[model samples]
Target: MKKRNKFKHFLYLILALAMLVYALPLISFKEGWSWASAFGVAWSLFAFLVIGAHLHYLLGVDEEKQKTLERIRAAKLREWQLKWPEDTQRRQENM
Candidate 1:
């Protein structure tokens, strides 16, 4: 399989593991497991997810944050211009 496919499989595996953690606590609680052990298992699962997230970011397998910020800024500027047409015209003329 290709590298990207492998990565996707890895992510899916992680997702499955995360889902398992969500279900495990409920099962453990029902099975009369001790609170301390349950908490430990949950905490370890959370740490696993945290590490997985960091690894994902390190690999840059996501959209660029700057692009999202730029889109937000552009939308805000458009909203401001719509609310204050005269201010926008004045700023444009000043340039």
Candidate 2:
């Protein structure tokens, strides 16, 4: 229902698909696929997993940053409210 939850679900789906794509080549290679082709596929899968791990780490960092920002923003807003109760009342009056 919430946008943030939707985004989390979408991110999970993307990661799953990426992992599946990276694994497909290995399964095919085990089924008597060409040596050269299998090597290339395996290498690509290795690279994909490495890159995916890096991206996943970066996403975690970004999520932390977002939470920190939200907390800072909320604190600032609360401070503002406490400092200017009259202003808040004035704004409500104008509305």
| TM-score of each prediction | 0.34, 0.34
Candidate 2 local lDDT, 1-95, one digit each (tens): 55676576557657756776766655554546788767767766675666666566545766788899999999999999897988888899999
Worst 10 residues of 2 by lDDT: 22-31
lDDT by candidate, in order shown: 0.71, 0.71
Best candidate, lDDT-wise?
A: 1
Candidate 1 global lDDT: 0.71
Clashes of each: 0, 0
The regions of model 2 sitting more than 4 angstroms off are 1-54, 57-59, 88-95
Tens digits of per-residue lDDT for model 1 on 1-95? 55677577567757767776676655445556787667868776776776577567646576577678899999998998788988888899999
